[model samples]
Target: TFHSFSLILSVGDIGYYDDAGQFYIVERMKDSFKCMGRQVLPTDIEAVLLSHADVAEAAVAGVPHDQYNEVAKAFVVLKPASQNKAIRATENDLQDFVAGI
Candidate 1:
């Protein structure tokens, strides 16, 4: 009917802490990418994608690149009406977006 201190701390250390050490709930952890040796936040990308009328859901990931080391790859789920929407956006588009951040 008892538990060690290590077990208690381990069970409670599941969240994000900022520089100030304030804890916050993490909705998702896989939604992160590293580009040009920097952490590219996905919430920004998701915000932009959501702004577009066609995009329903978007998931982004870092894909290996021969030159850049890693590049952002967006897996978008489009609305039914936009199913036929072409993949007009290119890797350059994502690069530009990340750069602007």
Candidate 2:
């Protein structure tokens, strides 16, 4: 479909602006997962995971699901404070946090 070489190219990144007017590329169009008959953007879930004070880093990937075809599996690195014995952060607690959002 190309007659001549063109310098313009599309990177397929999806971006958005927040309330502060900050431009951020949340996810790449190719990276979106199909779940519940809809597209689930990893960055959207990552943003919510990062909102938690205990989570220092977060990553989401598509995993096989029986009903939805695919689901988001999150990997998180907790902050130093949360690692302390005084602060108890359970797997269920983190799951509930994401589910609440």
Q: Candidate 2, residues 1-101: lDDT per residue as tens digits?
A: 22232232133444555656544445545678899999988889999999988888887777778899888888788877633456855778889999999
Candidate of highest TM-score:
2
What are the clash counts of all predictions, listed in order?
0, 0
Model 2 — TM-score against the truth? 0.65
Model 1 residue 97 distance off true place after TM-score fit, in angstroms: 8.5
RMSD of 2: 10.2
Q: Cα lDDT for residue 39, model 2?
A: 97
- Regions more than 4 Å wrong, model 1: 1-31, 82-101
Reference-based TM-score of each model: 0.48, 0.65
Model 1 lDDT tens row, 37-94: 8877667777777666656777555667777666766667666664576555544664
lDDT per model, in order? Answer: 0.56, 0.72
Q: Write out the backbone clash pairs for model 1.
A: none
**Best by the lDDT measure:** 2
